[model samples]
Target: MRRLTAHERALWARVAASVKPLPGREVPKLPAVPTPAPAPAPVQPPAKAALAPGLPRRPTAPTTKPKPPHPLGASLDGSWDRQIARGRLAPDRIIDLHGHTVATAHGVLASAIVAGDGARVILVITGKGRPDRPARIRDELMHWLERPDLRPHVASLRNAHPRHGGSGAFYIILRRPK
Candidate 1:
């Protein structure tokens, strides 16, 4: 092979000088310096900091696992009146989403269901659409209730009673709060 040019040799020498030597070299190893032991962390007392001079600090609220939304259109397989009279079911809350737009209704429904407030049954009044003028909310309510965000709050949905607007509304069974 031809010898490297002067410029090429000089470049190689600079590169070699900057590079660290690989392991297994013949260089003598120096005695390892002993590292000083880490100082123990300062002890801190477990105490709540006072918010005011006289008042004690308020305790933090306990963490709780949120209840999952219930699915939509789940069958009850029983009579509504009998269930209600027997204390098995009671629709304590009602939300009328009749005149509201789809977006507004959806937001309201989601918020209502999630808030729960110890209500066992909630009546969602979605007015039935006429044959010529279809009620978009009525058709889409169940589909919206089935969504991941709202499904956890609703256990099941059924047609409301005649006194409760019949086909124009639905009964949303909210899951019992843990």
Candidate 2:
């Protein structure tokens, strides 16, 4: 190769002088950049109603009236007398209104009333008089019959026939509602 001319050599020397010299010691490490924290999530309020169209309004409260007392109590007292005098009621449909528990008796009576308005004859089996005790099934039946709620609905009530249950059971006749 031909030797560089003096002008070309002078240009190369200037370029070499512009470049930085490598450090004698190892290059210093760059400082670490800190990572930014994530932004917090947005909070939302509870919905009182739906945002969609045609949605129904939410209910705020209940809407109903309390029931009134039953009207059957007064009628029960004279039901048998009226039936006997006018032949308005029959005894053949008597049902045995018997149960060991008070709840059962009440349920049976409620169901019987609902079923036919007490037109059907029911023989309630209250059980024989409790020995050595005055509180018997028969007595409880008497108490239930005496309730004001049940009186008006009862057409007639009497002791059961001997073959049916004697004093242990009662024949309850329900009246048809007018």
Candidate 3:
């Protein structure tokens, strides 16, 4: 065994002192952390002053008038017109284009109209478009209806009555299969 040097002896003495437990003393406990207070909410701005001083502010009427159910078609034949007006021309089949992409809607709509089977009037429900993106599917569908592939299958197209779907949907009249 090698004899300890003077410097090594001092280091060992320090280590021995640290390791030795105090006989009568308890270990000191850590202090609790203080939590910070929450920030105050921002105050809202006051309402604008009325136009006139004393006169009560007249309730403003709605800017746009409510549109009546206006049916659109290629010169509706007498009986068909009467039936449509009376809301008696109920759709034999229905297809909703909600949550479908433009490409998907195009393919599905074309296939549905082409394979309309025995249905005379097919109801197409393009949900009243998102407030952010105006009548996208509805406009696309209207344009799609004019294309050669889908056009042959369709005889007439009309805006559905409020009961059916209002401005958001169309009533597609399918041609009789030969």
The prediction achieving the highest TM-score against the true structure is 3
Cα displacement (angstroms), candidate 1, residue 53, comes to 99
lDDT of 3 by residue, 40-127 (tens): 8877878876677778887988999898643336645779867877888889888999888889989888888888478888889998
| Cα lDDT, model 2, residue 75 | 43
User: By lDDT, is 1 or 2 better?
Assistant: 1
Model 2 lDDT tens row, 1-178: 9976555666766666576668775544333333445668877876755558877677778677776744333345565645544544445454454443667767676666556533556666666755675435556665676677776667666656666666676667677667
1-178: candidate 1 lDDT, tens digit per residue: 9976555666766676677777886544433334445779999997955577887666888799886644454345457646644545546899999789999998998888898588878988989889998999999987888888887777788778767777898888877788
Angstrom error of the Cα, residue 11, model 2: value is: 99
Candidate 1: minimum summed lDDT over ten consecutive residues — where? 27-36
Model 2 ranges off by over 4 Å: 1-99, 132-135
Per-model RMSD to reference:
20.6, 31.2, 23.4
Candidate 3 structure lDDT: 0.78
Candidates sorted by TM-score, best first: 3, 1, 2
